[model samples]
Target: MPRIKPLPDELDPLAAQLVVRLRELKTHGELTMRRLAAGTGYSARSWERYLGGTSLPPRAAVEALARLTGTDPVRLLAMHEIAAASWDIRRAESPGEHEPEEQRRSEDEKGERREQEREQGQPPRRLPHIALTAGVLALTVAFMAALLLVLRLDENVAPAAVATPAGTAATTPPHSYLCRIARTDGRWSAGINNGRDTEISYGDTGTDVAEAQCLLRRAGISPGGIDGMFGPLTLRAVKTFQDRAGLVVDGMLGPRSWKALRG
Candidate 1:
């Protein structure tokens, strides 16, 4: 019998999740690092590093594990996503790039001294009231100009005519389809609609749904495989989504309420 290698001590939350998953698989006799190494032609040391959270596993390693364990690669990939996002957030919050309190205070003092020198060298500046009034006038003019420009642009940009589905009277409220929705453009847009038009903003759809589902899963709603489908799994996902979006617990996807979710 081969001994299972231990994970690294510095593992982040994501790495820790992976370790938990691996341990579950081990209990189920689904995989062992030595077995995985033999199957994938990777060294046991490489397997240890990949599973230990010291390094990201190659896509091939993930695929191989899925095959060996009788698990969906897509689901495994989703797990990796959670880990990566957690790592990114941790990196952003780390104090490595922050200035010390003394350094920040010194910089602030230097800026104040420079402003004082400029004030002493120059003639008394115009009254702040006059300056503020002029600034407001300039901003109003600029806003008017921008409004006109936007109106002109709208005129040039043709709108797509989404014809109502046949036999569905335009006067009747648009048939409410069950969908798994997520926030986009400060509105809640559907992630999964039953083979209908689910218009998510470009560069927003897949990644956002994956992230939202990841959060929902942590909150105890299983969103299936995060494949952006509005099926039963995603409907289960909506209860959690609604709670986070501050909507009534009802699962119906109404336009006004869904719009609030896009935030």
Candidate 2:
């Protein structure tokens, strides 16, 4: 027998938006979907589904595309949300209560039978308590499995903290910082201190160093590209900005650096 292929999942508006963005990027770069799939570690068929808006692309897939295209994932996520919201609204307006008439009749018949049994001056039928217990146990096991999967995904996807310099005491403020950053269509915004007033794009490489570079550039500091890789250029720019702002010149972009950048 020939192997059967799975049907494509129906595309919702949000999925459609994701497809559009991915296609736009691919077109501008003159790359094919197969090329993207190969580069991103996603299967070509899966890429087709993702670009066709037939399904939501996994977070990893989104990140891979962003990185490959040298674009930011944050902005892409915002568009996804907008599309999702519109899809949700349309669903709400449509008729979702489509229970089969035969199924309703079957339920009514069962209810009548129960009532009739009660009227006969006899004890009501006892449901199989064991079945209910077994069901609960099965549900609990399934829930636990799902929880574990989510935890694993988080562990894998979450960014690790940047290593602080050695000899930095625990009492001292953490050497590395995490900054909230935003990007839209390859353009990034200035970073805000304490994640406040910061409209971060989803799945952004939200490392503090990356945020610092974005802020630096916005403030005319221009600490090189927003590659999320902190290097000597970034450090030099941070120290220069710190000196001008009369803050500690540790060459680390911290709270003081953030404040100075914002100012």
Candidate 3:
């Protein structure tokens, strides 16, 4: 797998969410940029721009990635919509390179229309239309802003899982891990990853997290699902297990937790 560069630090939070999920999907599929390009019908350079957080990806590209990874595209598509909306909002708030030119064109058009109306001895007939348009636009923008705010707050609390046709929504992704617990050399193993002593906490991610999740499940605790993401539920599970096993209940998985998990 190619080493993915870190995303730009100034990226919007909503956009960051989509990009992170995309990176996770790529990791899960074990696909490089070239392979992803070949499979998804996008240029490797474009993929770099999208995955690097320099540019937002199109809806089609996002869906293509989901298909290539053999994952359902619904959640990805919803995320894309939020990212795109957030991008549009940010762009509208910022001045664009073409703003000056567009403003000049708009002024010239208004001047010409005024001159024509003056010559025809007609009063400005566009006032009502412009007022109505502006009012509608203002309302739309306000509603979108409110919606985005609510979504951000909800996401911070709990990430919503997309429901599939066959089942209800779940806290984890559809993919699941099959625990292959076994004893080897007097140490326990779950066959997900040989990651002893790897420190993991909330917001951490990778196969190691997945391994911990698998072990937690085998020990009769739920880590919210083996989706490779260490979120709040996973942290709670770790703490619960630690308390039960008479270890430090710091909720940080380290060597002791790993040993206990493996044991």
Q: Pick the candidate with the highest TM-score.
A: 3
Candidate 1 lDDT (Cα, whole model)?
0.50
**Per-model TM values vs. the true structure:** 0.32, 0.31, 0.41
Give per-residue CA lDDT, model 3, range 1-263, as digits (tens): 35669987768777888899999888766677887897779999998888888788988798778756646565567777667876765554443312432244564775797798799999533334566557656755764675465445443244345544454342233455667888898877778776466888866777788889888988999876677766556777999999999999999999989999888
* TM-score of candidate 1 on Cα atoms, chains taken together: 0.32
Better of 2 and 3 by lDDT: 3
- Report the lDDT tens digits of candidate 2 across residue range 19-132: 666777766544566667766799988877666654566656776676655554555544554455545433433323223333334547757876887898776333357775
TM-score preference between candidates 1 and 3, better one: 3
**Segments of candidate 3 deviating more than 4 angstroms:** 97-263
Query: In every candidate, how many clashes are there?
Result: 3, 1, 0
lDDT of all predictions, in order shown?
Answer: 0.50, 0.55, 0.73
The Cα RMSD of model 2 versus the native structure comes to 18.9
Question: RMSD of each candidate?
Answer: 22.5, 18.9, 12.6
Estimate, for each residue in 1-263, the C-alpha lDDT of model 1 and write its tens digit: 45556665656755576556655554454455665677567788887766665666655666556544434444444455455555544444443423433354455775787699798896533434766557655654554454344334442243333244486333211112234545455644444432232333212334444544444554566765554333334554566667777887565445533444444
Question: Positional deviation of 220 in candidate 1, in angstroms?
Answer: 36
